[model samples]
Target: MLLASIIMHAAQPIRKERSAASIYHLLQGKRSAQTLQDAHMYGLTHLFGIYPKLSRQLFDQVAASVMNEAERYENQDIPYFEGMTYQTQTESFLYRLLLLIQLLSNHVREEKRYIPVTDNPAVKHWIKQWYRQEQHRLDDWRNAIYKELYDLLGKLPPLQAALFVDRLTGYQHIGLTPGQLAGKYNIHETDVLLYQTSTVHHLLHHAENKAAIFPYLAALTNQPVHKTRTITSTAQKTRTMLERGLTLDQIAAVRGLTENTIKDHIVEMAWLDGEELSRRFLSDTDASIILECAAGAGTKKLKQIHALLDGKYNYFQIRLALALRRGHGVEA
Candidate 1:
């Protein structure tokens, strides 16, 4: 129900304007220019890439069931989901925390051997390095971690906190799997996953913002913990070319892509880099006209805006302008 609710909430803003698959792609964190653009345009950036492994069959089923009752799933205050900003580091951060907890649990019992919670080599390597560094001060490390987690989890809702705590593999207590958690809580496995994700995201937010309070916890993540938004790699390449003063046609030829593809990259960059690049494809006056048309027509639909302008601006131009408008947070 929580996963469905989140999907339904994301669908509402772009209902009927975009296909169901678009929402699926958005949740899956497709790196396409279109998906990224849709996220910014529809104000779904926070939810973007929240569930990268969502199965298509499940999404279609949930999407079909909730299409008519989207309003019923409206969440006035959805839990913290800065997927766009935090997706890259969330899993690694969680892995480090879990592995650290498991290590601490066993170390306290003077146990040298225990199956690890995560098989990821990178996580294991990081944990090993950290343990070696703090070996002599293991007790202090453990106490600090406990204090940090106690204060941090206290800030979360009870259920979310439980989900986080239940996933930890302590000395004698094996952590619960998502399936086990689902059965225990009587919610769908997917909801359990999402709840766990929400809990981790909340903790990550606190760690990044309140570094003083969560020093050890914050130090667990090896990945950059800043909240910087990013663009797709392909679009990033296009941005590099643009910086070199290459025209759209020249870029297409050099990159072996169509001019239209190049234009798409440009628009994607506009969404991230703002009017600085969008104005290259669309002029200020033309963009103003497009924004006015969008405001007057009460839509960001490119065709409608193009038609409103009597086909004076091509779809690409109108799209570029709308990207700027959305980037600038222009009213309407």
Candidate 2:
């Protein structure tokens, strides 16, 4: 139900402009310009990249059921997700927490031999470093971690908290796999993943925002929350050329890409850096006209906006204008 609600929420805004596959790509973290533009254009940025490992088969099944019962999944308040900001951090944070819990649990029981929960060399290496620094104070570290988790998990829904706790491989207890969790809760396997994701995101948000209150948990975060979204590497190159006063056509020629591809890069940069770069492509007056036309038409379709304007502005101008409408100003 949670995954369905998320899909339905994302689908409602872009139903007229894009297909269901677009949303799948966004959730899978495609990192393509089209998916990135779709996220910002449809106000689905918060849901972007939330499920990178999502299967196409599962998504199709859920999306099909959701479209038939679309009205049932509206108005869901998904406050726990900040996928665009935390996409790189969520899984790493969870892995660290799980490993730490297992290590602490086994250490307290004086258990000398046990298999690690994860075979990730990086995670194991990081834990080894962390353990060495705090080995002499394992009891204090254990108590602190318990308190931090207790406080953080207390803020989540009961079911979500259980989903998180049940995944921890501690002491003699082995963590339940997602399939096992699905069967135990009588829900779809996807729901198990979503519930756990929501829980972790919630923990991350609190740890970052309420750091003073969650010192130990906050310290576990490997990266800071992003203040602005990032554009693709290819887009960054285009930005470098644009910054050097190169026209789009010239940049396209120089970079061996079509003019259309360069424009896509500009649009992506507009999504991330806002009006600072997009304004160079279109005048403020024209942008204002496009914004007004879009608002009047109640649509973000560039074709509709262009027709409404009697084709006075080109498609690129219309697109640039719309991208700038919700843009952030030059940051200090």
Candidate 3:
């Protein structure tokens, strides 16, 4: 029985080709003689099933107007044939309008519309009130679609459904190409595209169920805590060496790496050597004094000693003269 119903539904083709002249010709004779009930039934059976319910509402509303105009054409109160022609024209306009609406809905679903929070009180208040009213309906729709899709494809290997939602919504939010998102997540681009299509249907049905989707999305995209900690430690070390008057080359040599590599590290650490030192070590008077002391000691024996005291003494406290004149103390 289900199979038969599916076949019957599939057999009903959605009429896509449309033109004003074509619509006028189709409705010319029917308007003057057709009953509203007959028109409604014909339109519902022919068009309504192919589209979503919201679209059907628009179609029915326009159809109702056509029915009223047709009644006027039947009365012959306005020039009989001209009234019939005008009714045909109106129906044609309505048909095109409905087609345009469907195109827009598809575009919106594909593009993933995001409404921003507005500062205007009226807009904010209205959205809040509207959400309160529709929240339950949205939850119900989300649950239904999630269950339906799970039932259909759940037998496949357990791919993270939350991750799929994240990729879909991220694409919508960030306008990333499927290929880009796939690369970021280490998945196939085709999989991302497929998930995007499935998500569109789910979003349309459960427009209000965005809450659960975002939490999962955050988890999928969130930076790993350990990675963040490692980066932070590297940054702290870079800044300390930089403040201690270590040139990029010197730091690189000390770390036994290339100068460019050390510069890259500093860049990632958000440090700007000699140009804009980070605020992290900006207030450390000890660091500032040490850097000054070592500034001119780059080639002398004192330079080697200063390097030894790298993190220990401030520049002013290093006593350069005392060290240099150690064996010639009374020769002043």
* Per-model RMSD to reference: 1.8, 3.3, 32.4
| Cα lDDT for residue 249, candidate 3 | 77
lDDT of 3 by residue, 1-332 (tens): 11122122222221222222222222222211111111221221121111111233433444445445543333231101112112212222222222222223334356435433224454445434644664455445344444544543343234434334343222134334557767767876544543433333232222223535433222112123212321334456656888798987788888787765564455334311222443332334544444344444432133454676673753323332222221121111
Model 2 scores a TM of 0.93
Candidate 2, 150-185: lDDT as tens digits: 988888888778877888898899999999988887
Clashing residue pairs in candidate 2 are none
- TM-score, model 3 to reference: 0.20
Give candidate 1's TM-score.
Answer: 0.94
Residue 265 of model 1, lDDT score:
87
Each model's total of backbone clashes: 0, 0, 1
Off by over 4 Å in 1: 75-77, 223-228, 326-332
lDDT of each: 0.83, 0.83, 0.35
Please give the RMSD of candidate 2 to the true structure: 3.3
The deviation in Å at residue 253 for candidate 1 is 0.8
Error at 103, model 3, angstroms: 37
* Model 3 error, position 211 (Å): 5.9
